[model samples]
Target chain A: MDREFRNNKPDMFTVELFDATSDLAESLAHSEVIMRFTNSNQVLINDQDAQRLVQEANELHQKLYAKDASRDFMRENFPRYRELQNQIASNPVLQEQSEAQEMAINFLREVNQEISQLLGIDFGSLTRRPDATC
Target chain B: MDNLTLNEPEVASKSRVMEVARRFTETLAETAQYRALEETYQAFRQDGEAQAAYTALQTKQQTLRMVTMLNAVGEEDRLALKQLEDQFYGLKSVQNYIQAQETLISMCQEIGDILSDAVGLNFGLACRVGGCCG
Candidate 1:
């Protein structure tokens, strides 16, 4: 028999199950924490200064890993890199984005933990990719 | 920033969202694949022969740790390890257990993808199920 027939022999069961999932999804979409995170992240992503700072950081990181990079060059640019890092860290939008993102992640973690506790197994672990290290 | 719409009328309470999560978990447990996986896992756990094969392989690996780490495992030891692995894999019970597990994992991954799409974060990644490496 096909999987659907096995899992959903009773149509009402499938409907109720999906309805619950959709309800949870809808609530998640309307969450204040998630909304704040999404909006703040978008603002940070759109900010020119923030974008430049990120690009500068990436370039500095790449240079640090470059085969031909000299110790002197690193020593020379390290201070500037630190300054840029501090600037990024000090940006209010970035900071709020970070906080909101953490809150959103925590929210999901709490939800998953609740489900796992109820189900007697780690739901997230069960849902992980087959090749995942865990 | 706009006040969150979550605080508006028709908002879902935390308890309600958790209820939905519980329902979803119950639905997942009722699936044929998940039931099969649980049954096969129980069988694997109860199978004395399979357990012995697994324990023996683990013991052999532990005893050969030094040789294996040094990449100097003797031909005889290598052959012995391969034989043990083959013997373990050749068990019908072990094979069924493994297949059942794979099927269940696949189904879970699909459901996780749906949850991730709805929640705007990779569900497994957000849960940190295995580790942060992925």
Candidate 2:
């Protein structure tokens, strides 16, 4: 039996589903939390001082985790990495971005909860790709 | 930057976000994939033979749980389990149910990808219960 329901051309129902998904995405993107997140992200990106600190921390993080890095090397660089992380965390732009991101995530979770409630399944878990690490 | 607050009047209210989410869920319910999944599941539930086969398989598996875990199942027990599995899977209702589920999952994965792209986050991963760390 040919059981495949999908084809190269989607049916009207599939088109409607996609459109609704787009509308939801648009609403979420325009929501205050997401808007704040976007704005804060922009601010963080435009801040040269924050970017430099982030870059420096990232480079140190890579070195610390490198296969050839000795225990002594790790010990020497770990404190500096922590200090750089502290500086980045203290930056107002970065702080706002972090908060905004957290808010956006919470909002999305709430939305997912609503969807799951109506559908009688965990939408996120069902939709998650098989290869996804998480 | 001043202390960021989510209480601003300019932000989209939670009610509006929920409304859009409801719309998305309603649209998803209308999709062919979802409809097929629902119908097949109902059919599978109503299929006495398929349900009996599944119950038999599960009972056999439970009976052999300890032996199976230790890889010490006797040949007769193993063959019995295999036969039960085959019987359960051979049912048309079971096959239809599985196919419908796969199609629905594929549709959901596409939607997840779209939402992830639009929201600048892995929608499925973020909304997952317990999340990546958990």
Candidate 3:
């Protein structure tokens, strides 16, 4: 009862879902919008927009990959947590279990909501970019 | 008495029967596996070691291909193992489950068929933009 759900989080699960959602966004941005990769030089898909999708996508991909490393901490410790949760499932003192479980649920909800928002924007207007031949 | 007897087209009769059988059997199997996968995801989401084992599963979900969506069914199963702490119905919403799965098999496969002769890779992960997306 004394434990705060948000204090200890399941950051790994959040990162995993985030990474997956970002992948879809990256692909769409590449083909439909940014179009291709560039380094120092910027290329245009046609006349107006810069074809730097590959670079943008790579940046996003790198961010996702970097954040993904946090999962290692969760991956390393989740088993012990489960073991404790199972052992204490029937116990009248659920303060600790409740705390841990709540933290996880909240973390997942945050990730789901965040990824949903990201996809909503990327998929909505960006996906509908006017069709043009490059 | 013979007035009730209707002559059926040769292809029509066989096709109708086959369709009916496929629907019944596929629905049953899909339901069972879907439920099992849901449980597995729940279990895994709550457990970390299982989550690590499922890295391949996670990668598969995000991979672009015509069938990536279809391939994501397996992701649901893997998620069950990762050890999330959320409170959810042991049973997922039937409509959501069906829609997701249906999209995987139908949309993914259809997209794959439309894009290439092959059936795997769903839509093509990372999609490089090395060649024409269309």
What docking tier does model 3 reach? incorrect
On residues B1-134, what C-alpha lDDT tens digit does candidate 3 reach at each position?
Answer: 45445431112232332333233223323343334445554565665544444454455445534354555445654565333312122224433444444433432222222221111111232121332321
lDDT of 1 at A85: 85
> Relative to the unseen true structure, what is the C-alpha lDDT of residue B23 in candidate 3, on a scale of 0 to 100?
37
> For model 2, how does the per-residue alpha-carbon lDDT over A1-134 read when each residue is reduced to its tens digit?
11122233233335677567777777777678888888888898899998888899989999999999999999988999999989988888878887887887787789999999999888887778988763
Tens-place lDDT per residue, model 2, B14-75, is 79889989999998988788889999999999999999999999999999999999999999
Docking class of 2: acceptable
For model 3, give the interface RMSD: 18.4
Task: Give Cα distance to truth, residue B101, candidate 2, Å.
Answer: 1.0
Top candidate on DockQ is 2
Ranking according to lDDT, highest score first: 2, 1, 3
Model 2 misplaced regions, further than 4 Å: A1-13, A65-68, B1-11, B60-81
